[model samples]
Target: MSELTQLSPQPLWQIFAKICSIPHPSYHEEALAAHILHWAQEKGLHAERDAVGNVLLRKPATPGYEKRQPVVLQAHLDMVPQKNSDTIHDFATDPIQPYVDADWVKARGTTLGADNGIGMASALAVLADDSVQHGPLEVLLTMTEETGMAGAFGLQPGWLQAEILINTDSEEEGEIYMGCAGGVDFKTILPLEREAVPAGYQPLKLTIKGLKGGHSGADIHLGLANANKLLARFLSLHGQKLDIRLLDLNGGTLRNAIPREAFATLALPQENAESLHALAQEYLAVIKAELAAVEKKLAIQIEPATSDAQALTKGCGDRFIALLNAMPNGVIRMSDDVKGVVETSLNVGVVSTEADRAHIRCLIRSLIDSGKEDVVGTLSALGRLAGAETIAKGSYPGWKPDANSPVMHIVRETYQKLFNKTPNIQVIHAGLECGLFKKPYPQMDMVSIGPTITGPHSPDEQVHIKSVGQYWILLTALLKAIPEKN
Candidate 1:
């Protein structure tokens, strides 16, 4: 309903509006891809969809620029589906409702999908606009980017002819990303023995919520509380004093996101319930003061609850607590090469109570392969000690920064020339499709840039209005400046 058509750089804004009108959450992007394929044909450009649903559109070079090397403008097709708890829209069927708020465009109680939608739109606009001089170009719109790098991984090698790739998925307008962290997810299954609730004990629930958990990689160093760790800390510290036994415990939703909420079921003597409450308050006070600046709404709720789930045996509970306390969670090392960048980190993202076993999901990220293995080795050894099974899956490589990259020089010079300000060069701790793309296209020079998007992957996501125009100008200029091939 919002008037995106009237936004500056009307060509780009118009395409963005069409994208926002579709429901294209991760892994459900066929309809949008079909629409784009048809639109590309109507516009008299060569376009086709690959086996994995990635759409590639080709545009010819202008008369004078025929000798320049071709460039691939890459953007993903899917968006992360997240909304406010009270919002009534379904991501699979409902169009995103975005509106201009001050200088930023935001959606109504949901993510704006600006993370890659803006990238896709800018690529589409470049393909459609003929007045801008450029060399031969190809636009690659990938699917299933949010849930994982499935689309990028499925892309076969030797399919693209472009020598350079320009990714429009980076969030900051004034920063160009040259590298990103590689990561792997490991699920540890800890088997704990259960026993009948003791006659003298009663059931109580320890609930923790309102922690501002963020991207496990980017915000790992922020010292945000992992709810699972917090819960385990309390149980481990007070289990003996209060004669505590665990029923089951769960926390977090995604392995790549910091755990925000967690709760544990417990059985303890009724006489110790009041003492338990007092201890919880005391612990809460200490944490509140420690995290006052970041976690303002941090809360821990204590309530009585009845459960048929048997409590973990005292020995099992104690061992479980010890395992949790030993699990690695948070930044492990900072980069020595890239100043202020995190080199290796681990997040205890998820802990779920299953029928027979408790499953813990952790994502480890590092700029170097050995760094990931080091953490994995620690986890494997701990799992062996606890008689747990550790399974690793979906390993992806990092995009190591090339100090001598040719494209990096061109982008930096162009940004300086266009805006009269030097852009920041960064190697992010988060995952990017560029990392995967490099596996097959090793010779392809790649750099990522985009308009400033704040609060990505959440209901508060917004994209700056002014930065969009600036981004477009830089992209247009960069394409023209691409030198002719040798």
Candidate 2:
């Protein structure tokens, strides 16, 4: 048996192990979907797929609970594909090699996929376990949630019959999330003008790596370093004192992840090369001191390069660097309603330059619609000032908390009775599909809960071993405690 199969909560861990063996990265879930369909068929459960690739599995009520109302167990089917720059694993072909790390389960140099994978496993285990008592159950597995809410947005009005939704996507084990922040993607594109490399100039590459880039929503409040922003500051600050031309610059991979690495190629007068090297070292020392506590390994490396490529015109380079330095990133506002919770934030997640264009992508999130709009407007103004065109897309609404929700009471009561402690009833800054699901089913009551998952969307991702068992118990108890429909 695999190491995961030996874990406590055998059914859930085993299912998760199987899931890891298949490739289910966002927008590439066909193989995993087929596997799930085959598993449902083998288990003789009624399963169907929606037009947007969402999978729904139905299990009849237990013998004595037939009169109780049906419940929907929801989780996204896709996982964010993130790996260390030096890791050789492929999300498509290689299975996540998860191993026990003391009290947690982590993968080898890549994301563990526990953000929603464990939730998916729990639902599947419930369907397979005849020993567990519960009412009628519907497992709604959505697709491509990491990239965008494509599956949630495409959900039809009648896609689900259950009014009570239990979303198994939240990261904390002892927290029940009733509301989440809404988000929009802001992008800016600037036309680039490249000029022939001036005579007596030499090319050099500057790279910034080792920043602890993480989930833009969950970790933005931690004050981590953004490599893109740092690089821009260095370039802009030094450009004013040196004769240099930017050849190319790029950083980050996903729009929802804080950039951890950045690279820039520049051409400068041969006489200034040694001075540039000294300045880079000086800047590195300054930045290291600024982020020493949070980003210990943060580094700035400069090396010689042999290239004859043209560089961006001085005007364009200066403008681009200035705009980046001025971009708003990290936490914008803290929640006044919920103590210690982030109400609004933005992440400058990606920046890249092509032959004739430079692009900057950011993800903005806020608890209130007005707050979201304000941030978008701010980004637009910045883009306009830099002679770039700005566009916002993939906007989704936030889920509003229902303080007097009947289902919340039941879940709270059940959790306390089982553990002799209260779970934290809270709202998260991260985006959840429960927000989008509310559009078609406005009356649906939703709560998001899951085992403890740390460092999601990064190679350091891990899931607590003991929390999964507690989560399973709580889930089962809540299912059995659901009241009958009037």
Candidate 3:
């Protein structure tokens, strides 16, 4: 019930409010696309949707600026679906219920979708504002961005005539993203064989939660808590001492988001109960001290599990522990050319245990293809050593930075003039649609920027209330500052 008037004077927030009123989860964005199409038509701008439901709206240059080259404003229309355990909002049909906090705009209990929704809103605001001087503009909004880059990848070549693209998807406001790491997800399977629970063993459930998790790519280098890694560390170090039998294990929800919490159920000999509790406390202190500055609420709790007799073989438990320990979960290398860019990284994102099989999802990212393959090879070898099957899927190539880009000059000058300071130019360890788009336009010039956003893939995702105003001013200035083509 909160009104949009409480936000800043920028009209992008108004468009964002209207976008929140629609239900547009990944792969189900028809209604939102239709709404955008209607808005474009009302403005007398040419608009069209691709076969996969990606929408592109075109606006001609203002009368005197017709000689300038056209620019494409890009953003994804789909959003990652995540909600709190107690929230009852359905991503498929429920509208995002957002409210204004001191300086942030966030939803009640679900993901705010500001990742790219704010991008789409900014593009719309530009398209609707006629008084602003600019050259020809194309607003490209793609679908299914969270699950796969389907809309972006499936976009036909030559669909847009613009050679310069501005992506409004990066999280930081003052930074300009010139390149990004490519990535792929690998699904590893381990055949399961259940065994009868050994006598004198009691089932216990261990839950690791309350970690402040962030984007797997952006925050992976921060040495934050990954629940899967913590849980595996516990089992690896104490499996022999506790005489444990694995029953079920699971952690993480999304491949792109860092695993915040994980849980596992197992049966352990009652004789070692006190020893196991002490070990848990020891590990908790070690991890807490390590992540005290970042994840203040990191927790590890143990309780009796309500399950009948079910367990895994001792050999399997040991092997699982070894595999988890071997898996990589942080920044692998730093860029030599770009000062602070993460060149390579990996995330052991998801793990699930079932009666007949255990599955693990690992996401690997690297600016260099060789580094990416090297990480994959290391993980695959570990899986082989543990006798588990592994297969990689949805591999994407990186968008290497074009240092001699023409747009970079204008972007740098515009940023310096607006902020009174130089913006940091760097490549990110996260996946962006720019890589896929470049496949279609090899010579395309591109740069990414956005208002300040935090907790992008989580329910805590929020956008800064003041940065939107600054972002809009910079974007409009860039469009007008570009020299007109003859």
| Top candidate by lDDT | 2
Question: 1-486, model 1: which lDDT tens digit per residue?
Answer: 447889988999999989999999887898899899999999999998788888999999988999999999999999877675458999899999999989999999877899889999999999888987889999999878766678898888888989999999888899999999998888889887988999989899998877777677767877878888988888888889999988989887778777777889899999999999999999999888988987888888999888999888888788888898789889999999899989999989889886578899999999999999999999989899888999888888999888788999999999999889999999998888898998889889999999998767667678999999999999999999999999
lDDT of 3 by residue, 198-248 (tens): 888888888898876778887888887788988999998898878988898
Question: What TM-score would candidate 3 get against the native?
Answer: 0.95
Tell me how many clashing residue pairs each candidate has.
0, 0, 0
* Candidate 2 structure lDDT: 0.91
**Candidate 2 lDDT tens digits, 1-486:** 288999979999999999988888888888999999999999999999999999999999999998888899999999988888899988988788899989999999888899889999999999988988888899999999989889999998987988799999989888989899999999999899999989988899999998878899988999999999999999998976778899999999888888889999998998888888899889999999988889988888889887666899999999999999999999999999999999999999999999899999999999999988999999999999999999999999999999998888888999999999999999999999999998999989899889999889888899999999999999999999999888
Clashing pairs in 3: none
Q: Which residue runs of candidate 2 sit more than 4 Å off their true CA positions?
A: none
Candidate order by lDDT, highest to lowest? 2, 1, 3
Highest-scoring model, TM-score? 2
Q: Against the true structure, what is each candidate's TM-score? A: 0.92, 0.98, 0.95
Q: How far does residue 89 in candidate 3 sit from its true spot (Å)?
A: 3.4
Off by over 4 Å in 1: 1-3, 84-90, 304-306
